[model samples]
Target: MKSITFLTAMTVAIAATGAEAKTRLLVNCFWPSSHFACSTVLPNWVEEVERVTEGRVTGIIPPKSVAPPPEQLAAIERGIADVAVMFNGFFGDAAVGPKVAMQPFVGSHDAEAMSKALWATNREYFADEIEQVHLLSQFVISPAELYSQTDTPINSLDDLAGRKMWVLPGPLAEITKKLGTGVVSGPAVQSNEIISRGVVDGHLGLDPQAVQAFQLMPYTKSTTKFSGAIYSTSFSVFANKDKWAEISPEDQEAIMSVSGEVLGAAFGRAWNEAAAMAEAAYADAGIEVVDVDPAFETALQEASAFVTEGWLKAAEAAGIDGQGALDFYKSQIGEMTN
Candidate 1:
């Protein structure tokens, strides 16, 4: 009986040691628990990591954000968080490499394509700009769809004239201004008050899936589906350099197999699927979705030139062929669609 007990104790000890050998990474999900990043993307990515590593390495998202969105990258860089996701625009110029993803008229409404294109382009050209953290996946918000409080038809370019509209900072703001519309600029969170208080006649930066998260469907009565070049926000999921270094080379290869562009493409596909749901929600909410004519599309395309030109110039200053990157991204997207 003593020898049998000794053998069982040794078996348990070996199992405990093997379990301790697994590397568990803490994934910092600053988005709300219900937010897609917390509820879906991170969770799904974590599963992939565990599966690919065969329990060699895994990750966990804390109950609350370790830091605010803008600070997520810095937090990871400082080692406060092992992994994090950041909105590239919030840090402005720091994530200049992926800014190509934000240039209007360059991509289709296909989120998966855009996400994959950005990752491919980054690997090809802008990896230097992303030196601090290990870029896991880079992506963009689906193009913005204009939502208004009334079923006012925005059929012609002239219809938007003088209307107070909420625009996110950057080229979209320029496009809104060029349309002869008044711009009310603020973050997405401010849309609720801005619309309720009549500060802006409508918000121009949210699509249907986004509206569901913001609870804007109840207040919105109309939506305008712009052409491929509308607008979008860029973001990236990354890991701390040191934390990444701590991961064994074999595990690193395993982790990245499911990360980077693969993970980015997954995020885009998920969001695009959610976009379909948002469209249904729009119908249920009685929101009118206006499809403007070809003329309006031409005008939109024309206005977007300024934004694209400026991005190109900025890209050139950053020391690479900006036009080359843009062209590559578009070509990559085309390939993905095919």
Candidate 2:
């Protein structure tokens, strides 16, 4: 009888231990599985998470698996995904702190500097908005450049007037429209289709790697350097608030230690590498790359004022202090770049 009781107690304890040990986290990436962010950065992040957690946490990334880039945040909020990489521009209707980062002329062309600035901005002013979800990391992509099929170069601001251009909807689209270009809203992944079909005369947001990743270089006849980083997208790795709450405090600290500034720098380095690869690919493809004339760069800078004004108006409508946030973000970017 004593032996039987001891055996039963051991069995119950083993079952309880097994239950407690089981942990699964779902990580969603909007980019296709082949993209560097999904293929390289995510895997490295997963390894780091598991290593720090010591087998208490495990993550699974489904192939080509993601919600619409804009919907990633809602998916997490609804518990469809425990964690996801979200783009701030997608939250057009909300008070996302990073909107200031997307305003024209606010960020430098350097992804590393932009990423650091974004992280610092979050720490100083946007913490509450992001705290709703457990932010794992923050990063920014390189600025989008102009790619065109026309042999005539974009040497001046007037060159863009009345031209049909494929532009992603949101802040970037707003900037394109302000430039007097006919804007077509479409996913970045479909840029090849748009260019191949001649639905667009050119595209305004082709990052070097993105152009190469989607094979847009073949269709691209010319590339124009923008005055400054025309615009950049902000990305954040976040988990559901409840799910993050379940993590042990020690585990949370471990994760946070690896996130923010450190993770931002890692992503920036990856983007820099991707940019190098893209430049080589474009050269090999015989595509013409031109630096915008100084006069044109100045025109672009002047045009940027309209974009900034529009952002301020939009932010006011959303009940956020647009000017204050913009000022803070600018100061942070200056510090990081300097």
C-alpha TM-score for every candidate: 0.91, 0.89
Runs off by more than 4 Å, candidate 1: 1-21
lDDT of 1 by residue, 282-309 (tens): 7788888887688877877786788888
Instruction: Give candidate 1's TM-score.
Output: 0.91
lDDT of 1: 0.81
Residues 137-223 of candidate 2 have per-residue lDDT tens digits of 778888788877777766677787667888766666776687788888778888888887888777887688888887787778888
RMSD (CA, Å), each prediction: 2.8, 2.7
By TM-score, the best candidate is 1
Clashes of each: 1, 0
Judging by lDDT against the true structure, name the best candidate. Answer: 1
